[model samples]
Target: MIFWAIFGYLLGSVPFGLVITRALGLGDLRQIGSGNIGATNVLRTGNKGAALATLLLDSGKGAIAVLLARHFGGETAAEMAGAAAFLGHCFPIWLRFKGGKGVATFLGTLIALCWPVGLIACATWAVTAAVTRISSLSALLAAALAPAFAWGLGRPDIAAAAAFMAVLIVIRHHANIRRLLAGTEPRIGRK
Candidate 1:
């Protein structure tokens, strides 16, 4: 379990957004909009391809960690790995502990752990984003709903893991939450 968790953390710490942006010569992602190394901020770079790649890679890290841990270890190891992966994305040591908001990794981990709940969460995010055109709010709504969905699906362990990741995601979105309440949070495509 410990080994899987550490491996997950290390894998999750890869910082795909930063890597992708740099590799594409988009400039330092940390100096871009919101100074965040996440898919949404990557999108702000005006490169849809880079943003899509970042999203997939970030999510893939979490999914891969859970899948590998589950295969080599067990369900508990999978859970630990998933949670650790989320944490690593949010607080990667490579970036001085400042990292992404964990939305993509959270969804990926949840999907790998429980596909049904993950699908529901993803759908909730899509619907919310369509209605509000706000990525942060959409992610928050999805994270908020994932635990409940897991619980309803009779997966208490998954619910607990989802709740943990959801709380951290919400914490990371503190500025966005404040802006949202003040009606100042930017829309998805707005510059």
Candidate 2:
């Protein structure tokens, strides 16, 4: 279990978004708007391909870690590994304790627990983003809803995991929450 947790963390700590963006000559994504190192920030670089790749790779790492833990350990170990992956993405040592907001990582974890719930969460994000044009709001709402969705699906363990992920997401977005309330939060594709 310890080995799985450590391996998961190491896998999650990889800042693929920053690495890919920099490799593409975009420089540090952290220096850009919002200072976030996620697919959204990659999108800000006007490179849709890079943004998509970042999203896929980031989420893939989380899913792979959890799946490997499940294969090697068990359900409990997989859960622990999933949480480790999320934390690693949030406070990656390689990135000076700075990293993405963990949305993609959360999705990956959910997929590992239950693919249907993951699909629903992804749909929620896409619909919310399309309607509101606010990626942060979309993420916030999806994260908030994940636990309830998991419960409705009769997965208490997954519900608990989603609840924990939601809390982390909210905490990570404390600043964005303030900006949102103040009507100062920037919309997607708006500089």
Please, what are the lDDT tens digits per residue for candidate 1 over residues 1-191?
Answer: 88998999998998999999999999999999899999999999999999999999999999999999999999999999999999999999999999999999999999999999999999999899999999999999999999999999999999999999999999999999999999999999764
Candidate 1 clashing pairs?
A: none
Per-candidate Cα RMSD to the true structure, in Å, reads 0.6, 0.9
* Clashes per model (N, Cα, C within 3 A): 0, 0
Clashing pairs in 2: none
Write down the lDDT of every candidate, Cα atoms only.
0.95, 0.91
Q: Which residue ranges in model 1 land beyond 4 Å of their true spot?
A: none
The whole-model C-alpha lDDT of candidate 1 against the native structure comes to 0.95
Q: For model 2, how does the per-residue alpha-carbon lDDT over 1-191 read when each residue is reduced to its tens digit?
A: 88888988988899999999889999889998888999988898889999999999888888998899999899988988888898899999999888889999999889887888888998999999999899899999999999999999999999999999899999999999999999988888775
Model 2 spans with C-alpha error above 4 angstroms:
none
